[model samples]
Each structure stands twice: as C-alpha cells, then as structure tokens.
Target: MPALEITDLTRLYRRKGGEDFEALAGVDLTVPEGEVHGLLGPNGAGKTTLCKIISTVLLPTSGTVRVLGHDVVTDTHAVKLALGVVFGGEKGLYERLTARQNLDFWAGAYGLSRRRRRARVGELLERVGLDGRADERAGSFSRGMKQRLHLARGLVSDPGVLILDEPTVGMDPVAARDFRALVHELRDGGTTILLTTHDMAEAAALSDRVSLIDRGRLELTESPGTIGDLVSAYERVDARGVPDHVRDRIAALDGVVSVREDQGSLVRVETEQPDATLAVLRTLVDSGVRDVARSRPDLEEVYLHLVGRRGMGVDR
Candidate 1:
C-alpha cells in the first residue's frame, strides 16, 4: 500500500462576516512506501493545511486521506500509531523538561511501557545526536538543538511514515546539513517521508519526487531531475554593453521568452531553444559585445516561474 493517499481533499474555513475561504481544493496526492516526497508551495498555499489534515490534527471538510492504508477519518488510532509528525521551530518542546524527560513523556503517550520508554528515549537521543546533552533542559537548547529534540520526539513511536513541515527553517548551515543526513538515514531504514519546505535546494537535495501546489491547487508533480530538465529546455544569456538595436533584435528572435535589462547595462535574454540561445549569442558577439555568457535556470527559477512571486509568507 502507498504510505499516504489523499484524494479530492478540501478544507473550508468560515470567516467572521467575510467570504468563506477554501484552503484546499480537491487536492489529490499519493506517496509510496519508503519515498521522500517534497511538497513545495508559496505561503498560504495549503501546504500546512494538508499536513495538519494528514496528521489528524484538523479534519478535512471533504474527501479522504489514508496513511499506511488506514483512513485518517475512520482509523485515527491506527494512523497515529503509524505516523510521526515534526513541525519546524522550537515551540513544541517543554521548556522545563530535560531532553530525556521530554522524549520519555512522548514515548509514554504512545503507550510504551516504562522500561521500553527508557530504552527508546536513549536510542532516539543517540540517533538525533542529542545523547551528550540528554539531561539539558529543553529551554536551554539552541534552535538547532531544539529542532533535534523535536525530531527525537517525533520518532518516539518509531512510526513508518514521517511528515516534516519545514523541519530546517531556522537551522544553521551545518545543522541543516546534519539534519538532512539524518533524513537520508531514516529513508535508508525504510521510513516514508513527506517533507514540506520553501527551500528549493533542500527539496531538490532530499526528495525522490516533488509536488508543487499553488493557490489551493496542485500544479504538477515530478522528480527533481525531471523538474530540472523542464527548466533546462530554456537557456539564459546575459550580456553587457549591448546597443538598444541589438537588444531589440535579440528580443524578436524566435523562441526568445523574454529580454530584460538588469542593473546598469546588463541585458538578460531567456530563450526556449538552443538555436535561439546561439542566435542571441551570435548577435551579441557580432555586435562587438564581448562580455556575454549563457547558462541554464535552476529549480528556484522554475518555482518562481511556475508559482510567481507573491504571498510568500507563513501559511494561515
């Protein structure tokens, strides 16, 4: 069975004296076992709403969600038993409790016996690199440390499917790298993961496949390399000291997507075909423009092209 199955899922929020908002509109997604699926969307794009519904923290207004073959609505207990959820930031940990104590509490909540909880807590602390500071109060931990603790808490149940909602939001570069390595370890051990994040590099680095959501709808789902290939179909050429006539000529070339001026005298020409890019370069080089270069777009550029640059903030 797929690790997660979401079909025609929708959520509506009734506003006070305002029009009711539909956060998710008939979204459908399926994640297979042992795959790391990345969810990417702008702020207010229903990513968080989807995560909450899958975790059973919020009910969907319509449609069905299943985790590990257990329907979220009809089998909450089984879903909970099979899932682990970790949201980004340091807000979920108990301030006064030591790392060991916090993990112990969460394990107990999952019905682990006292002896089992002790063993599981220690195992988790070591797994997340918190064993050295297992006795430190959670409040005394740094943001990275707290995030590690959060991950440990999420694994207290040894769930099969894990959902990480921006799990590296405020982490330093080093910490983020370590966290990603840990995720790789989890996936290697046969854990299925659903990761939502605004970081394009992170999504590209860790995901086996990725789904893009926009304005309460899913736009596309593809492997990261496939997405890269989509953008690779287009090429960009940047040149300096190009005359207005050359710029206009490049703009009129076939397959040229756009020609825009950057800061100062630099002009960027985006083209949809290799011939177009070559033509652009030939035109510039023939015009005595010696400072021209060609390159391909990355995942971030594709995201901005697909989703546009607007409403990029925390989801409501």
Candidate 2:
C-alpha cells in the first residue's frame, strides 16, 4: 500500500508587508510501505513545508494529500494517529519529566491503555538507549540524549508511518551512528519512514530513495543506487597508490576541483569534467597506480550539481 501521496501540493504565505511568498510550488510525491524515503534540500528548499502539510500542522494553499488512504483535509485526526513526526533540532522535551515519563505522556495522548503504554514505553526506551536514563529529567541530558528521546516519543504510539525531519542534525558522532542504526532497525521491522536531512552522509545512509527539492519545486527523485536514479552524474576518480609527483600533476588538471583521501590511501576526486578526468586516469597506467574506478554518481555529487546551478555557482 502507498503510505503517503501528494498531488499538486502547494503552500504560499502572504506576508504582512503585502508580498506573496510561495513556499511550495506544486509538489508531487509518493512513498510506498516499509522504506526510508528522504526529503532533502538546502535551507530554503521547502522540504519542511511539504512535511508540515502532510502532518496537518499547516494547511496547504492548494493540493491533495492522503496519508494511509485518508484525505489529510478530511481525516486529520485519523491521519495523526497513524503517523509519527520528528522535527529537526531542539524541540523541547518536558524537562522535568524522565525519558520514560515523556513516553508515558504521549502514549496517554494516543489513548493506549495503562498496561500497554508501560510495555511499549519500556521497549522504546531500551531501543533508544534511554533505559539507563529513563528516570533522568530531560533538562540534564546531553544533546544526543534528547534526540533519542525525541525518536522514542514518536514511536510510543507505534504509528505505521514515521516522519523524521533531520533526525540526526546535532548529534555527536557516536550518537548519530546509533540513531541511524535505530532507523535502519525500524525499516527492517516494516515501518515506513519519510525523512529529511541537511547532512549528506545522513541522507545517503538512511534513504532508500531521495527527492531533491530546490526552490519549492521537485528537482529530482530517485533511489540512492542507480546513476540513472539521480538527476546528474559526477566525475569520480579513485587515485590508488599515487606517487607525489603524479598526484600533483593530477590535482593540477583543469577540471579537478577537490580530492578526498579515504583510509589515507585511495582518493575520490571531484571534477568539473569527467572526460578530462578519465583522460588523466589513462596516463597513469604505467606509473604503478594499479587500481582506478569511477562512480556513476551519488547524492553529494547531485547536491553540488543542482546547488551549483541554483546557488549562484556555490557548490553544496
């Protein structure tokens, strides 16, 4: 079953100063069951606008959205019960309450029974590493701790669909890793997730398919795999076992822009022109550089490709 669908979705704001600012410019999207679909864009790309409309917190200027087969405009209460939403960053927890108590509060709001709520709360807290901190008030917890509690609160109701907006935004490295693993575990257990993120690593890691929104329009939507799945391809060159002289020569090539060393060995090169990059690779065949490979493309590349055009030539 399709967990969510949007057709001709749009939202526009009329400022008090008397100008019209369109936040969404006709978005069309679908999310199937049991997968992680990423809604990714830069700061003002309108991903949050789309999510708010689906979650029914903000009404659309014009569009149709159905969550779990119920029209958002008509069946808002039902949709709320069937879905969970996690927004990015510092959404306050009831600082006086313990992690377990926060879950308890949401569970009561969701109308779960006393026994069932306790059971579910325990399970969720354990899953999110808050079992140890269940009794601690939210105000004293670290940033990472708060993020976990936010996720656990969303799952307290056991909603069929999850909306996670930048779930790992401000977490420490270890915390971020743990949170992503939790997301993967949920997907494995048949929870459909619609998520957004500014972190390229986070988006690439969690997204089964990703929609790139730019300037309030659907720039592209496709799976994380398949070069054809994304809107553009980036030049990737794996420079293996390069001597210093050759490395400098390759770096000085016209199209080469940046180089990232992996494990201090192989380097991934970002280039302006792939054809020229390949030509550079061809010349190093006799220089003991045995391994060379190129990717069709990835989100980081697509981000730059689109953001470059849209961002006054500033690559993402």
Candidate 3:
C-alpha cells in the first residue's frame, strides 16, 4: 500500500453570501513509502487543506484519505498515530516555556513513558540542533530555530510519515540548507514525507516527484523537472530597442518553438536544444540588438508559466 493515498477528495465551505466554495475538487494523489513528494500551488490551492485532512485535523466533505492503510476518517486514531505534521506559523508553543519543556509536554501528550520521553526529548533536541539551547524559552529563539523545533516536535512520536507545509518559510540560507539535509536523512531512514512549499528551487532540489495543484484540483503530476515538460529546455532573452521584424526573424529559427514578448522589454524563447543559445544570441546581435542576455529556465520560470500565466492566485 502507498504510504499516503487520497482519492477524489473534496472539501466545500459555505460562504456568508450563501454560495458554496470548493476548497478541494476531486483531488487524487498517492505517496509511496520512503519518498519525498512535493505539492506545489498558490494559496487556496488546497494543499494545506489536503494535509490537514490527512492529519485528521479537518473532516473532508467527501472522498477518502488513508495513511498507512488506515482510513483517515473512520480510522482516525490509527492514522494520527502514524503521522507527523508541521504546518506553517506558530502553533501555540508555550512562549515562556523552555524548548525542553515544550517538547516534554508534547512527548507526554503522545503518551510516551517517562524514561522513553527523556531519551526521546534529548535525542530530538540534538537532532534539531537545539540541545545547546535546550533551556532557552521558545520566544527567544530565532525563526529558523523555532522551525527546527517544530519539526522535532512533529517527530517526537517517531511517526512513519511526515507532512511539512512551508517548513522552510522565513529560514535563512544556511538554516534552509541544513533543514533540507535533515529531510533527506529522514527519507533515507525510511520515513515517507508529503511536503508543500512555495520555494520552487527547494521543491526541485528535494522532491523526487511533484504534483501541481491549481484551484482545488490536481493539474499535473510528474518529476519536478518535467512539470514544464512541453519542451526539453528554454531560454529567456531580454533585449532593448529591438524591432518587431528582428524578433520575428529570431522566432523563425530552426530550434525555436515559440517566442512571446513579456513585460518590461523581455522575450521568452522555448527551444528544442540547449545548443540553440549561441544561435539565438548571434541572430539577436546581428539584428542590432546589443543589449541582450540569455539564460536557461529554472523551476521558478516553469512555475510561473504553469500557475501564473493560467491566472491562479499568486501569493508571492
């Protein structure tokens, strides 16, 4: 069985205006064991709603979700026992309590034995690099430190699956890198993870596969690189004072597929081969376009093309 399975899941909310809003519309997804699957979407795309449903924090209006072969609704206890969730923002950690105290309180909530709780708390603190500041109050910790603590608290029960929603939000470069490494360690240790983040680069770097959600539905599911799989590669060329005739000529090149003018004196070029870069530059330069620069498309570009151009809600 898949570590996480969701089929035709839908959640609806009634507005004060007496209209129904669909938060999730017939979404289906599966995450295999020991894999990192990324969910990417704009706000209100239903990523967090799905995660909440799987974690048993919200009831689905319709459809089914199962974790580790247990139904999330009917077998809520079993599913809860198997999941570790870290949602974005502060989730009511006692600000005045030391990190150790907060962790101890959560560990006790999980019903850990006194002896095991002590060892587990100590191990988690060290794992998240908080052992050095174990006695410090949570309110005094940095954003990155609190994020690490949140992750540790999720793992306190040693659950089989981890769900992280925007886990690296507000983290510094160094902290984000370290946290990504920790995620890899957990996956290597056979922990299945369902991750959602607005960080396109992070999603591309860590996820073996990714699902693009849009307007409460699954739009595409494939390897992260293949999300914009329409072309093998692409380039963005920005030129100043270039004539329309010259742009047309460049678009008619052998490897070029489509050329679209973008805002602020930019043109995007989709190509069939990476070697098309020099050819494109030569064409543009020969056409009296001196101010031209070319670069390959990254995940951000692809994501923009997918969700942005489609008119989805862009939070960033």
| Per-residue lDDT of candidate 1, residues 154-246 (tens digit) | 899989999999899878888789899999999999999999998777988999999998778888999989865666677899999999999
Ranking by TM-score: 3, 1, 2
Q: lDDT score, residue 161, model 3?
A: 93
Alpha carbon lDDT of each predicted model:
0.89, 0.80, 0.84
Q: What's the TM-score of every candidate structure?
A: 0.86, 0.79, 0.88
What TM-score does candidate 2 reach?
0.79
Which candidate has the top score in lDDT? 1
| Model 3 whole-model lDDT (C-alpha atoms) | 0.84
Worst 10 residues of 3 by lDDT: 307-316
The lDDT ranking, best first, is 1, 3, 2
What does candidate 2's lDDT look like per residue over 1-316, in tens digits? 6999889998888888877888888999989989899887877778888888888899988989998897888999999999898887867589888888888998998999999999999999999888998998888888888998999888888888999987887788988888889889889999989999866557777889888887788877877664233333356778678777777777787777666687888877766675667766775676768788866545545666665544333211
Task: Please say which candidate is ahead in lDDT: 1 or 2.
Answer: 1
Q: What local lDDT does model 3 show for residue 141? A: 88
Identify the runs in model 2 with alpha carbons over 4 angstroms from their true place: 227-270, 274-304, 312-316
TM-score-wise, the better of 1 and 3 is 3
Measured over all alpha carbons after superposition, the RMSD of each candidate to the real structure, in angstroms, is 3.0, 6.1, 2.8
